[model samples]
Structures are given as C-alpha cells and as structure tokens.
Target chain A: MNHLLLLLPLLMPLYGAIFSLFFWRNVELQKVFALQSQVATLVSCILLFMAVEDKGILTTQVGNWPAPYGISLVADMFSCIILLAGSVTGFAVFMFSLQGLDFPRQAYGYYPLMLFLQLGVSGACLAGDLFNMFVWFEVLLICCFVLITLGGSRPQLEGSIKYVTINFLASSFLLAGIGIMYGLVGTLNLAEMALLVRILEGHESLITMAGMFFLVALGVKAAVFPLFFWLPASYHTPPIAISAFLAGLVTKVGVYALVRLFTLIFVLDTELTQLLLSVIAGLTMFIGVVGAAAQTDFRKILSFHIVSQIGYMIMGLAFFTPYAIAGLIFFMVHNILVKTNLFLISGVVARHYNSFALKDLGGVYLKQPFLALLFAISAFSLAGIPPLSGFWGKYMLAKAGLELKAYALVGVSLLVSLLTLFSMTKIWNEVFWKKKPDETEVALLSPITNRMLHMPVVMLVLFILFISLYAEPLVHLAYRAAIQLLDSDIYIRAVLYQ
Target chain B: MRTIILSIAIRLLIPLFLFFSLYILFRGHNHPGGGFIGGLIGSIGFIFHAMVHGPQHTVNTFFRINFYGYQHQPTQSRSIYLMRMMRVNRWRKRKRHYLERRNRNRGLLHIEPIDLIAAGLFVATTSGMLGLFLQEPFMTARWVSFYLPFLGRLGTPLLFDTGVYLLVMGIVLKITFVMAEE
Candidate 1:
C-alpha cells in the first residue's frame, strides 16, 4: 500500500499526460484534466507524508523486485516534504497555465508536456538509484525543451537552443559522474552505493571526482554563479506560464539533487567539499543579487533572484549541520512558492500593461491595487522580511552559520539579503509606483479579466501569508527532514530492508 | 509530375511494409519485435505513400476511409430509409449527437497528426492500468499463459507493446508531418 502511495505522485502525472493527449481537441477538458491530476498529486503527496510520518521512511521496489537488484522508490521525510512542496507548486502553475498560456501554444500540447515535466520532477525526487535520477532529469529536461520552444517564435527558439545546449552538456556531466561512480563502486542503487562508499577504502579521491562532476552538472541546473547565464537568457522568452513553472521548480530540483547527492552518497572529503561549497554559496548569493539589480525586465529580474535564492539554499547545505539543512529545506519550499507566484504576477502585469520592460510599466498600484499587493507580498517575502516564510529560513540559516562560526559567509548572506531587497524595491518602484508612459496605448490591448489571471497569484499570496503566520509546523517538518537527511543510515536501512 | 514506376513501387511496398510491421508486432510477444517497431514500420508505409503521392492525397484518403464513411445507404427513396432508421433505433440520436460534436470540432480545427500521438498515448496508459485492479503497482506486467490454436501465451504486455508501438509511430508521424507542412 505504501509502495503504491509512493508511486502515485509519479504515475499520476504520467497517466495524466498520456490521457491528456487523447483530449487534445477539447482544450477545456485538457485543462481540467491537468488541474485534477495536479490536485490528485497534491493529495497523494500529503498522504505519502502522513505515511512517512507514521512509518519513518517508505521504500518500494518496482515490479515487486527487492532492493539492490530492482529500481527502488524511497520517500524519507526530506523527499516527501520536497515532493509535497513540488506538487503544490505544480497545482498553482497548472491553474495559472489554463488562462495564462496563449491558444496556439496551448494547442501545441502544453498540458501534456507539463505533466511529463512533473513526472520527471517527481521521479527525480523519489528515485533511489543514481541512474534513475539521471533518467528522470532527462525526462524533465526534454519536456522543458519542448515547453520552452512550443510557440516557435524567434526569441523562444533562440532561448530554447541555449537552454537545450547547456542542459545537454550538464546531462553529459551527470552521466559521466554516474558512470564513474558505478565503475568504482560496482553498484547503482543509492543505498547499496552509500554502504559501499562507507566500507570501501582507498577510493576517496575517485569518489570526490565523481562528486565534483555531479556538483558542476547540478550547479549549471541550479544556475549558481558562472553557469547561470543560460537561465536569464532563456527564461524570459517563453510564455509567462512556462517561465513561472520553470522558475518555481526547475532550479530547485537541481538544489534538491545537489543536497541529496552530497548528504546521502558523496559524504567523503566533506571538509574540502563543504568549504568549497560555502565559497560558491557566498559568491552565488552576491553575484545573483548584484545581477538582479541591473535587470529592468520583470521576469529577468526574478530569474536573477532565483540564482541568489539558490545560494541561500546551498549555504544551508554547505553548513553541513542538521540545523542548516533544515533551514535549507524551509528556504527551498518557500522560494519555490514565492518565486512561482512572482512570475505569475509578472505575467498578469505584462498582460495588462502590454510590456515586460519595467520602464514602460507604471501606475499599477493606482489601477490594480490588488495585483500590486500580490506582487509586494511575494517580492517582500522573497527578500526575507520578518515573519514571512523567507525570514524564518534565512534566520535558521544565519543562526546555523553563526553556530559554525562562518562569519564571512554569514555576512555575505546578510548582505545578499539586503541587496535582494534593493532589487525587489527597484521592481516595486519602477513597475508599480512609477507613472505610466504617456505614449503607451493601454486601450489597444484587449482587457483580460482579473479573475483568470489573478486567481493563482492571490491563492499563492494567501499561502505565503499562511506559511508566515503559521511557520511552526513547517519549521518542525523541515527540522525533522534535516535530521533524517543527516542520519543516512536510516534511509539506507529502510530501502534495503523494505 | 507523376512518376509511374515510383508510384507503382510505393503502392506495392506499402502493403509489404504493413505486413512486416504486423509480423514485427506479433514477434514482439516473445522475440525482440514489439509495438514500437511495428508502429514505426507501419508509419513508414504511410510516409512512403505520402512521398510518392503527396501528403495531401494521403491525408484525404486516410481520413475519408477511416473517419467518415457513407452512413445512409443509397435507396430508391431516401425519406423512407431515414424514417425507417429513425423509427427502428432511438439510440441513434446519441450517435448522431456524437458525430455532430466531432464534426463541429473538425470544422473548428483540422485534426493534426499529433492527434494520433495523443490517441496512442491514451492506449498506452489504458493498457498499463490493466494491472490496477489486481493491487499491483502501476505498469506492473501481468501475463496470462493461454495457448491458442495458432498463437500461444497471450498477455497484458502485448497490449502495452501495442500501445508503445502506436505512440511512437504517432509521435514520429506528427513530427514528420509538421516538418513537411512547413
């Protein structure tokens, strides 16, 4: 029963995508089907979490095969928590996509591809083997490629090409790393490999090398530091729906993979790797925020901020303490929701104002105060204002860093948070508070009803407020997930035994 | 522009391709052949036909034969036939309604080759769900060892393979058709 529950999230999307294809002509049915599937996924994830809460960790071998020989699906607290967050984001994005995506693109199999992408994400999070993780990533990436290029506009094509090329390179790096690990350890199952890594002697350097490959691959995906160029170039070109979904989920999956790999399988040479990660974390935070300050485009600024937020998550991982990991977990869930909401709000603004350029956009506060409020809530939450979801994550991370006496990294994190606020303020001022351009013919664009556009954003904003006012349960869950992550033995034993 | 030799050769080869595809699909029951390869081969038949006779003709013939066939038989009195049919079957209204809705959709948007892909996917997913009733996990293979007079050992995997075959072919057909259209 638990095994079926574990498979439900992944399979729901798979079947949804398959069946959605059959309903291509009836776009309404397709949208409802996709939305229902996402809702079902959300419920299953909740159920999985409840089960995990009761059972400690749930593991299932596909085709009734035992672990080590068959593909395994394991959901510890960490995986279940992330899957839950992902499904929530998925549901929100599907709601947004229904009215947000243009007709031609929607007709081009948008919902099916989105479901396929969700399948990839769910599979990646729950995959108990390195090879399966890679395959899942490929599935996720392939769907993204099609989604990004769905419209076949010049800019979309250009962006997709860059996105595809860099991602392909990253996949190669991941595969190379997986191949090396398999060669060295003679096993692909993560639990078996973790056991092997502990028992095997004299292969620390090789293991570290493989770990480096995984880092580089995931770093590119997470858009950390130098590898982040492809993100801003490509993310702003797709339809706002696709951009919002990608912004919310894609890079976070990278962070999830990074944290998973480092904490679970690649624990060797931690001092050196952790030190290196801290440096990257500091750099990633600083560079991302600074870059955001220079962007005038709404989605582009959010894209840069995505890089910065990732840095904070990595910082949590870098601290390598259970507290920091807990913080990272909280930060990831918060960022995914907040970031997706911001992008969706941006889409609404772009639709109304007929521009993504902040310079042309103005008087949003005067005209649509509610949209402005939604943006402010998400943007401020993103910048770590007190009592909001982001604040708790940052607080946990900062305290964790201070405990480790990593003052420089802690200072950088604080500085980055401040700069993130500056960037958000820049957007708030330019896009919302500034005067509308006189020459712009806002009347030329047909009026889109606020209900379809604002519904998802409003729901997300309410969610942010809820998480903020009631952070205790979430914080506790993150803490528990972190503890489970730190104690790798329990995860291994669960997978092996069950 | 019609090349007699090329057209003739394609006509002969199309059936052979289809025959080979069926052979491959049946062989997939035990051997390496399956729905995917069969679908590929079958699609190749249509693709070849398109290349020889043009995609427009291929599409017209295919749709005409499969989607819309003559419903009312040619009679000395059309009114009498219609009245008799209407009186004979009250359930015909639902069928007529379905056809009307389908025809309306067809007028709204010409069905693209991608529709085939979607149908193929639907089939694949349905076949995979056959195990759901047995408390097995999704897509879990359930086999039945029954011997036929001519064939042997049928199972759910064959259904799955057929689904895969159709899906792959549909996808390839959609892609190739779109490219050709452009």
Candidate 2:
C-alpha cells in the first residue's frame, strides 16, 4: 500500500503523457487528460500524507528491486510536503495553460512535456539515490529545454541557448560531484551516504568539497544569489502560463533537493557548511530584493523575488534545527502558490494593459477591482504580512534563527521582508491602484482577451486562502516533516535495512 | 589545367586518409582512435572525391545509379552496411548528372571545391555525434556477434565508429543540400 502511494503520482503523469501523445491533435482530450492526471496526483499525495502521518518514514524500492542494488524511493516528512505543494501548483498551472493562450497547434507537444516534467519532479522528490536524483533532474531539464524553445522565436531561441548552456554546465558539475562522492563513499544511496558520513565524522575536507560542488550545481538550478542572472533574462520570454508554472515550481525543487540532501546526507560538517550557507543566504535575500526594487518590468521583478525568497528557505536550513526546517517547508509551500498566482495575475494585467512594463500598465483596479484585490492579497502574503500563510512561515523561521543566536541573519531576513513589502506596494501603486491611463493608452490595449485566464487565478487564490485558514494542520505536518528530516536514523534504517 | 592539377592532388590524398580512418575505427577499443575520427576521415574522402571530379561528376559516379542486389531488412544488425552502399551509389549518380548539366551550362568554371569541403565537414561532425549514441546506455562496452561471412564478435567500439562515419557523411550531404539551395 505504501509502495502504491509512492508510485501513483509518478504513474498518473506518465500515463497522462502517453494518452495525450496518442491524441495530440485533440486539444480537449489533451486538456482532460492533463487535468485528470493532476487531480489524481493531488489525491494520491493526500493519501500518502495520511499513511505517513504516524509511520514517520516510508521507503519503497522502485521496480521491485531491493535496496542498495535497485533504486529506492523514500518519502519522509520533508519530501511529502514538497510533493503536495508541487502538485497543487502543478494543478493550477495545468488549468492556466488550458485556458490562457492562442497556443499554436505545434504546442501539442507541451502537455506531454509538462507531464514528463512532473514525473521527473515527483521522482526527484522521492528518489533515495543521488544518481537517481541526477537522472530525474536531467529528465526535467530536457523537458524544460523543449518547453522553453517550443515557439522557436528569436527571443525563445536566444534565451534557450543560454538556459541550456548554463544548465548543461551545471549538470556536468552535478555528475562530477556524484562521481567524487561515489568514489569517496562507495555508495550512491543517500541513506547509505549519510550513515557513512556519520561514521567518518572527522573527514572534513572531502565532505566540504562534495558539499561545495552540490551548492554550485543546486545554486544554478535554484537561482540562488550570484548565479541568478539567467532567471530574469530567460524566464520572461516563455509564454505567460509557462512562465508562471516555472516561476512557481522549478527553483523550489532545487531548494527542496538542497535541503533534503544537506539535512540528511551532509549533516556532519553542519557547522562549517551552515555558516557558509548563512552568509550566502543573507546576501541572497539582500541582493534579490534589491534587484527586485530596481526592476520596472513586472515579471522581471517577480523573477528577482524568486531569488530573494530562496534565501528564506536556505536560512531555515542554515538554522539547522527542526523548527526552522519546518518553517522552510511551510514557506516553500506558501511561496509556490502565491508566486504562481501573482505571475498569472500579471498575465491578466498584461492582457488588460498591453504590457508588463510598469510604464504601460496602470489602474488595474479601475478596470478589474476583483483582480486587483486578489493581486493585493497574494502580494501581501508574499511580503509576510500578518494573518497570511507567509507570516507563519516567517515567524517560525525568525524564531528559529533567534534561538540559534544567528541574530544578523534574523535582522537581514526581517529587513528583506520589509523591502519585499515595499516592492509589492510599488507594483500595486503602479499597476493596480493608479488612475486609468488616457484614451490613447486605452486604445493601445488588446480587446478583452480570454476570460478563461481568470479560472487559474481564482484557483490559486483559493489555494492560498485555504492554506491560511487551515494553517494548524499544515503547520503540524511541517513540524513532523522537520522532525523526520533531522532524525537521520529513521531514513537510514528504512532505506538501507528494510 | 589548374582544375586537373587540383583533381590529381585530391586523388592522391583521399584514399590514404580513408585507410587511416578505418585503422582508427578498428583499433578504438584499446586506443583513443574511434568511430568519431574514422567517420570524420570517411567524410573527408567523399569531400575530396567531390572536389577532384567536381560535384556533378562525383554525384553521377557515386550516387545517381541504383545499386542492384542491395536488400535491407529492418531487423538485421548489418542493415547499416547496405544503407551506406546505397547512399554511395546515389551520390555517384547525382554527381554524374550535375557534371553533365554544368558542362552544358557554365563550362565547369562555376563549380567550387571549397563548397564541397564545407559540405563534407558538416556531414562528418553531425554523423560522429549520432554514431556516439548507437551503443545503448552510452559509454558502456559490449561484444556483438554476427553470422555474416562466418561468425565473429564485433565490439561496440566498431559500431560506435561506424555511427560516427555515417553521421559525418549525412551532415556533409545536408550542408551541401543547404548550400545548393542558397
């Protein structure tokens, strides 16, 4: 039964991709298949949550292969929370993609690629082996390459070349790191690696080098500070729906992988790695929000914020405590929903105003009051204002940081939160609250395009509200996840000895 | 007079290069020389042939005529050998027709050997890349047994080399195709 739960999310997407490919020309069939797969994945995730509520950790060997020799897929608290969050955002993105565009016929390829990508993400979250994680990352990366270049326009091509090149380099580093780790430990399994590291606790240099390689590789993927230039340059060129989905989920996956691996496999050198991570995290938040403040393009600003928000998640890990890690999980879940919704709302604003540049977009409230309200709510949630999902995540993280006596990081995080609010207000004042532009500006806008766009925005808005209202159950789930993550013995025993 | 001299030079150099490439392909398992280098050499051979005889004449000699007795079975491991031979025959015919048309229209002065070389380079590079993947799971060595001309085991190194050769040849042909359109 536990194995079935682990396999269901992945199988749904794989089956969906196969079914959609056979009916490529039938858009309605494709949409139905995509939606059904997402719903199935979400339902399966809920069931997995229930089963693991008290069990603590579940391990299943994929393909019925025994542990160590066969690939193992393990879901402790951390991965399960991420999988649930990923499914929610993935479902919203699928709905948005269905309704959003005058997508060309060639885009029949998109649904299959999207499903394949989800399969990769699910596999990545559940994978207990390092090489298996790399394989899943490659699968997702290849699909992203196809999706980003789907339209094959000049901008898409240019952006994709950079995207592919940078990511390819990152992949090589990941492969090299895995090779080195394997050479050193003689095992690729995460649980096995963790046990080995603990046994050889004083081998500081080898562990640090491995950790650094991972940091660089995952940093590029996560768009963490200093490696974030590609995010703003390339993310905006994809179609708005694709951009939203990507903006919502992709980087967070990297952060999830980083948290899982560092917490489980490399905890021995925590003092050294966590200090370096804390410094980087502080800079990541500072630099990200500053970049956001400097941007005039709506998507570009949001893209910058992704970099900044990753800082918060890294900070949770840097604190190296269960409560902080729990806060990170909660924060990641909130951010994915809120960010995707905000980007989708930007899509709507672009539809009404003819541009994502602040100079051209104005008075959204005058035209669409409800849209403005929804945007404001999401923006504030992102800013970590009280009574929202974001606030709880920030509160717990700050509390954890203070407990750890990492006062400077706590201060930086607080300041970054305020700056985040300031930028959100700037966007609100420029795009939503300002007076409507003159007749000439109104004439420049496209005709009221696709009312269907509102469906995704509504779905995401309700998701955010649901999390805010039912914070207790989710917070408790996060606490359990955090506990499971810190307790390495459970993971090692399950995957290695089960 | 200049064209004849160029043709003679290419004729002298092409076969030696092709022989060296074959040597590399066969010995790749224990050494660095593999399918990629060998395929590149093969592409160079075709390119030199085009340069010396002129593309039209080369196409007529190599590609234009149908080569009888060539049968391709989709499931057969040795199908690639048949495909290569057919491709060579087609090239010969095309060369022959091209030379005839050029003689009638432009008196041979309009043909360019550099175009042929560029076309060859393109084919060689692409085919080499494709050839690299013919071996399954990539970078893993395997021994394949065949029953043709009695029985023998061929290593993946040879298969990879053949893939490289084909890739190079295909790329060169494609480049020429594009250039001709331009």
Would you list the C-alpha lDDT of every candidate in the order shown?
Answer: 0.85, 0.78
Compute the lDDT of residue A183 as modeled in candidate 1. Answer: 92
**What TM-score is obtained by chain A of candidate 2?**
0.96
| Model 2: per-residue Cα lDDT over A116-199, one tens digit each | 899889988989999999999998888888888878778778888888998998889989999989988888889988888778
- Per-residue CA lDDT of model 1 for A16-87, tens digit only, reads 886777677777888878988998899999999999998898887775667898788889888888888888
Per-candidate DockQ vs. reference: 0.37, 0.03
Task: Give the DockQ of candidate 2.
Answer: 0.03
Worst 10 residues of 1 chain A by lDDT: A441-450
Give lDDT for model 2.
Answer: 0.78
Q: After best superposition, candidate 1 residue A323: deviation in angstroms?
A: 0.5
TM-scores of the candidates are: 0.91, 0.74
- Model 1's i-RMS, to one decimal, reads 2.4
lDDT string for model 2 (B1-182, tens) is 33877777777777787788777767675677776777676567667666555555555444443343345566766868677767866775577556466543332123233233333333332332332244221123456566333213475435545656555555565455445445
- By TM-score, the best candidate is 1
Sorted into a CAPRI-style docking class, model 1 comes out as: acceptable
